[model samples]
Each structure stands twice: as structure tokens, then as C-alpha cells.
Target: MTPAEHPQPNAPADPASPAVELTPAAAELIRVLSAVHGPLMFHQSGGCCDGSAPMCYPRGEFRTGGSDVLLASLAVEGLDEPVPFWISASQYALWRHTRLIVDVVEGRGSGFSLEAPEGVRFLIRSRLVRQPAS
Candidate 1:
């Protein structure tokens, strides 16, 4: 899909939902990366270098433990199972009330992220979730 072709937002995703999302461009790129790297996953760390940019890795490359929270599983084409998306437990606390929109931008991001070699980066845009009326 071309950059103009945006991925359809996953249905039933609302501010109250913890499931993260991927833009069409982001999904398409993931498909391409998967072709070369096999299954993929994402982790948003509360550290430097990428500045909270979502880091993509081959499944099982990055170990997730108690400090990380599995926020969502994304279904992308070319992959048999949904890709897992995680955030640092500490970061999740700060973003617990928001919805994360994962997107792709043109540039080399963290070298550790597989997509970095492709001259593209995965970043997240978040918005606060509106609490229900009390």
C-alpha cells in the first residue's frame, strides 16, 4: 500500500481500551520488515536514544519481563499471529489513561529497531482518554 493508503483503525478501539493501534503505513512497513526478519513485535521503553519511539524486533529477540506490560496485540498481514505490543510498566503508568497510535515516519530511528536500517522509524502519538461521566 502506498503511503497515502492508511490502515483502517481497528474496530472497537476507544480511549478506555488499552489496545494500541497501527496506522496503515505502519502496518505496511511491518509487513515488509517481517518478510526479512520473520515475526515481529514492538516495545516502547522509558529510556533514551529513540525517545519513546516504539522499537521493533524479531519475535523473541527482546525479552519482556515484570517491568513490561503487554498493552495490545496487532494483526498484520503476512503474519500468522497477532504481533504483541508492550510498554514499560513505568511508562504505562504515565500513559494508562491515553490511547496510543503507532505510526511510521521517514528517518533512521534506533539502530536496535529492525526498521532503522530501512530509513524509517516507528513512533507513537498518544491522546488522553476521556473518562466516563461520574
Candidate 2:
């Protein structure tokens, strides 16, 4: 069979199966941020204050260690690699069963998050993933 006709291994049959998704506004902002920051990444930690907010940084600026869990890889326009969305391992433990949706709103979040300077913020909205009936 030709390459196009060959079945791709381990590919999701449904394109929307990912645990995380981005809103149109968020995707556009990510594209803009990637242009300014070169490449970007996001991390959300379970902590007080700013740590609870989703933080975006230029890739490699924020180091992910063993304590971090990669929850999803998001496809953004103009970026070759899918942007990684991570959370602290502990945070992931609490959120593991939920689907995270990354979105943008008109407001300033933590000043440290890259989007803060743009008069907007990136936030995560989550919902429990429905289980298949037994």
C-alpha cells in the first residue's frame, strides 16, 4: 500500500481526543507570542498565588523536572513542534481525570505569565472526562 494509504500507528481516530484544547483567541495569541518569544511553553502548578495560574514562557526558560507531568501537546499555528502543556506531578494527580481546555480572556493574570503584558491572560478550564459505561 502507498504511504498515504498505510494506517498510521497509534493515531487517534478522532482528532478531538486530546486532553487539552485551545480556543481560537488563545491559538492566535500563542502564534503571536511564539513570534515574539521564539518558542513558548506552558506550566500550571498547584500552589498559592501565581502558581495556580497557567504560566507561559519561552521554551527552556522554565525547566520541567521529574516532578512535572506533561498533560498535553497542543498544536499551534506557525510552530513546528506542538507546545507542551504541563502541570506539577502533584497537580496532575488531582487533575488526571479531567480534560483541560486552555483559553484566553481579557484581563491581566500573573505578571510573570507572558500573556500578562498583552492585556490578556491564559487560563485553564477543566471538566471531568466522562467514562464509558461499564
Candidate 3:
């Protein structure tokens, strides 16, 4: 898809079939992200059967595309570098309740890891979202 094309919002996400609510938090996240550069792109790549979920990166960085949304300035602590995220309050709430940790990665070599108490571990990769040319 071209830059103008974007995926429909919060549609049947993937394998999970969990109707993703474009909650206020998510909306805010979108809004905030759009302001920095290109439209935010949410990507999911995992097991063959496991449908992907919504995870936004700097627009145009991922192969897929995403709809336009609002943006805000929020800081996630514990990160070595500052990451500007556009997210809704409800999404943030979900992260809080779910104990999900969002992180910012600089390049192919760096990122955070998810260590769940139940021995569930996820190695999250990081990529720099390219800035659109002037």
C-alpha cells in the first residue's frame, strides 16, 4: 500500500479475534504519534497462527500501514533514552492492568525484554522509525 493507504481501525486484529477497542488511550497514542512524523504504523509478527496485535512504530518503518490518529507526549520510565509515544489513556490503563511493558528500541541491536513470572519470556526488537523527507 502507498503512504496514503491505511488499514481500517480496530478491525478484526488477528488470530486472537479479540475486538481491539480503539479506546481513548489508543486514540491519544495515535494522535500524539502522528504529530512527530508520518502516520503511526502498527505491526504484528509472530507465530503463524498467532494473529498480530497493535504495536505502533514511527510511520513508514514497517511494511504495513495504519490509520491517522491524534497524538500526545508521554514518557515511559526506566528507558535509557526518551521515547515519545502517542497513546490513549485507556490503552495505558490496559497496559497497567495487564502488566505489559512498552519499550523504545534504537536499532536492530537493542530493545527490551518481557519476563513474565510464569516463565513466559518475549524478546522485543527495536527499530528506528525513519523520518519522512522534507
Candidate 4:
């Protein structure tokens, strides 16, 4: 991995990783989910409650177009490939300056998300990103 894309010890702080990432638990769970569901993608909506939660779907099952923004392709350890994370364009407009983290928690997941049957759900947590002074 490039030092800028995947930071190593003592690496420069500038040119950090993507705007979104996955927690270890979330990444492990993704390894399980992807094994059963094949390739996967994540989409977060601008709505409330579960609607606001990031929903993981089998790739191609959910149609994405210009209205959706591809935030990042998150890497999960032991997985053959990265998972694409997407957000509604309008939601991106509101959250563009924040770093989004996907975490897995014990709960009833949305029926639409593949993780629902596993008794765990994916949640989005955010931290404000400081813009570099020009």
C-alpha cells in the first residue's frame, strides 16, 4: 500500500486515507458476509433511524448512478478485494467534511442489509475532518 493511502508508522499526516473506513469487527463481519453473499457494497442514506445506517448489499443488487457518490473502497483483512462504500449525493454534500467509520454492533439489522440474519448491524460513526489551510 502506498504510504499516503495506507499510512505506516512515522508517515506524514498529509494525504491521509479515504474519507471512510471500517472497524476491525466490521471488517471481520464483512469477510463472513462476503463469503455468503459474494461481492458486497455499502450505501448510506440521508434519512433517520435504520435509514441512516449504512446498508450492505450484494454488488449489482442495488443500482447506483450519478446520484450516488462512491466514498471509498474499504479493505478488509483476508478478503480478496475491497468493499465499495457509497453515499447518497445529497448526504455526501452534508457530510463531505467528515470521516465516516463503519462499525458492527449487536442489534437487529435492517431487513434490507445482508447482516440482518447474523444478528449484528453496521453503523456509521463520523468525526469532523480538519481541512488543510491553503
Candidate 5:
């Protein structure tokens, strides 16, 4: 599909308990990111405990799989290039166990975030965050 015609992730077929939480700080940040960057990208990579998790970026272009779900899309000015990203298989396993899916939205202090279940918060720049894309 054309970039402008990008499709959003269809609401899941099954509803489950929320596995992630959002702090007031996180909520405000996502609002800004959404207003500025537009759409965010979610990705994960290898690491500890949770193994790795999701992140967001301003929407542009991405080289991805046909089955890859497009959760949402945004158009931000100035950032005209696609930012590359990846998430670890281990992290994906964690996400699968919970109803929570890593997502991209505006953020505070950091450019992105990892909102865990029950208001637990983590910044995008933490060691807990990974960039397999790098």
C-alpha cells in the first residue's frame, strides 16, 4: 500500500487484561510525540529480564514484513527519513504472555518509553531499552 494508505492494527480479535501501565509523565510525553513526530514505531531487541521491548519513532518509511502489523501511522514534518528499528525475540515472548503490546506515543525527558503493567515506567534511553536496528 502507499505510505499515505498505511493500515492501522485492527483492534485485536480477543480482548484481555492490560499488561502495561501508563504514568502521568508517560501520558503527557506521548501526547507531545504524537503532536510532533506523528506516528511511532515499536521494536525490540536482545537483553535482560524482559529480554527487550518496544520503542517509537516519527513515521516515515520502513522496510518490513508483509504480515507486520501497522499499529498506527503519523506524518511529522522535518523528519523525512525512515528510522530503522528491531526488537528481540525474547521480548516478543514477554509481550505475547501479556495483553500489553509495546507501542509508540509521545514521551517525556526521553524521546520514547516502555510502559510496563500497573504504572511502572521506563525511559527509552535506559539499558533496558535496545536497538537491534543499530
Candidate 6:
């Protein structure tokens, strides 16, 4: 895809804490997939079927745009570049108050996701963030 066709991950401030994280299992799986696919990225669109799950794709394979939000840029050991995680703006809207934890489980994900062929799928588990009362 043309560079102009895809949305860039936001260079958001380096917050004191990240809003997203990956499980060790998930990071290992990502390492394997990245070795095979080169670089990779993640996006959750809150669509239908597999859309509810976080989908992994070869970096830039999926086109993101204004409707998407950059959730985090995760640094996994053994990977040269940080894997950017994104979410549909609407999904971020509904989930803004939560911390997203990405995990892997035995199952099939979207046919479009790079992990689908590996017999495992990537999923997200979230926890509500408790903000200090103003």
C-alpha cells in the first residue's frame, strides 16, 4: 500500500504509564510472527465477527485513518522496533477509561489477521482504571 494510504501511529507523549500492554505469551507469538512477516502492528476496530478481537497484521498491511486511535507502542524484547497498537476511535471512546491487556489464546481469529494461520488468536483483556477523584 502507498504510504499515503495508511494512517500513521500517533507520536503521543511518553505517558508515565502505557494504556496498553502485551502478555509474555502474546509477545512471544508476535516475535515468531514478526520473524515470518517482518514488522507487524495491531488494530481493534470493534466491527463484527473477528473485529472485536485485536487483529495483527504486517505493518502497514491494514490501512488506518482518522477514525483510528493510537493506543500504544509496545516494546518487545528481540524486536528492533516497537509494535504500534491502534484502535478504532469509537472503540477508544467506549474504552477510554480502561487499560487494555493483550493476550493470546487457542482459537482462530479473523482470516485477515496474520495470526489466523498460526492456530492461535490474539485477544484483549481490560481492567478499569481508577482515576483520583477531582
Q: Candidate 5: where are CA atoms >4 Å away?
A: 1-14, 19-21, 47-53, 60-62, 66-90, 99-134
Worst 10 residues of 2 by lDDT: 1-10
The list of candidate 2 runs beyond 4 A from truth reads: 1-16, 131-134
Q: Give a tens-digit lDDT track for model 2, residues 15-88.
A: 36676788898999999999888878898899876578789998889989878877677888778988988788
User: How many Å off is the CA of 61 in candidate 3?
Assistant: 0.9
Better of 3 and 5 by TM-score: 5
Per-residue accuracy of model 3 over 11-126 as CA lDDT, tens digit each: 22232321223433434444545555444444433323212223456644644323322222233232233333333333322221221233332222222211122132222222
User: Cα miss at 122, model 5 (Å)?
Assistant: 4.6
Q: Which regions of candidate 1 are displaced past 4 Å?
A: 1-18, 49-51, 131-134
Candidate 5 per-residue lDDT, tens place, 33-130, comes to 55565655554444543334345444443344543333223222334432234334344333333334333333232224433322443333321222
- What lDDT score belongs to each candidate, Candidate 1 first? 0.78, 0.77, 0.32, 0.80, 0.38, 0.80
Write the residue-wise lDDT of candidate 6 on 29-113 in tens digits. Answer: 9999999999999988888777799989899999998888777788999999999898887887677667789999998875688
- Give stretches of model 4 more than 4 Å off: 1-14, 131-134
**What ordering of candidates by lDDT runs from best to worst?**
6, 4, 1, 2, 5, 3
lDDT of 4 at 121: 92
Candidate 1 vs 4: which has more lDDT: 4
Q: What lDDT score goes with residue 33 in model 2? A: 94
lDDT score for residue 40 of model 4: 95
State the lDDT of candidate 4 residue by residue for 24-117, as single tens digits. Answer: 8999899999999898999888988899999999998988887887778888788888888888878876776678889999999655999998
Q: Identify the superior model by lDDT, candidate 4 or candidate 5.
A: 4
Per residue, candidate 1 scores C-alpha lDDT tens digits across 1-134 of 11112233322236346557788999999999888988899988888768578999999999998788777888886678888898887887567667889999999975599988888899899876654223
